[model samples]
Target: MNNINSGWRSGILEKIQGRLMKVYLLARRFRKHIKDLKNIPRTPRCGLSKQETIINKH
Candidate 1:
């Protein structure tokens, strides 16, 4: 009876550890996705960007 109880407890512990590992993996993947998204190229509109010249005449 004692051995059966111990086995059941160990199984529960293993399940908890597995769930924690999965959560960590998901967080890592989400972080990588955000970093990769930051590398994507963007299009400038209105014929201007921060590097372009702007001319104003009065």
Candidate 2:
């Protein structure tokens, strides 16, 4: 009877650990995605080099 109880407890613990690992992985991916989004606006827009040259001539 004791062995059965111990086995059941270990099974539950394993399930909990698996769930935590999944959440941690998801959080890491989310952080990277957020970082990429933050960089998008800081990047210079495309096709503006011609305007920049005209302005620089002044």
Candidate 3:
């Protein structure tokens, strides 16, 4: 029957919408985490620079 077909279509659409919402939520969470990390200041690492040579002078 046409009504049965419509019901099936509606069900499929609902499942697709649910999946899309879950993906959107995950993307938003990832974006927020990335933004938080970006806001943190990173200190530059000096690998055996002049400061260490002077300090280690014998």
Candidate 4:
């Protein structure tokens, strides 16, 4: 009976560990993606000027 209990506990523990690892990897990937976005340069707001011109013409 004790052996069966231990086996069941180990199985649950392994499942928990696997889920934790997946979450950790996903978080790491998200952080890297955010870092890459930050490294990109900002562009001027030309779209706003175009919109203003169109509004003025109407």
Instruction: Give per-residue CA lDDT, model 2, range 1-58, as digits (tens).
Output: 9999999999999999999999999899777756755665656765355444544573
How should the candidates be ordered by TM-score, best one leading? Answer: 2, 3, 4, 1
Per-candidate TM-scores read 0.58, 0.69, 0.66, 0.66
Best by lDDT: 2
Model 4: lDDT equals 0.73
Candidate 3, lDDT over the whole model: 0.69
Task: State each model's CA lDDT, in order.
Answer: 0.65, 0.74, 0.69, 0.73
Q: How many clashes in each candidate?
A: 0, 0, 0, 0
Location of the lowest summed lDDT over 10 successive residues in candidate 3: 43-52
Output the worst ten-in-a-row residue range by lDDT, candidate 4: 36-45
lDDT of candidate 4 over 1-58, digit per residue (tens) = 9999999999999999999999999899777755645544463467555544654573
Candidate 4 to truth, TM: 0.66
Best by TM-score: 2
Clashing pairs in 1: none
Descending-lDDT candidate ranking: 2, 4, 3, 1
RMSD for each of the candidates: 12.8, 12.7, 13.5, 11.0
Clashing pairs in 2: none
Using TM-score as the yardstick, the better of models 1 and 3 is 3
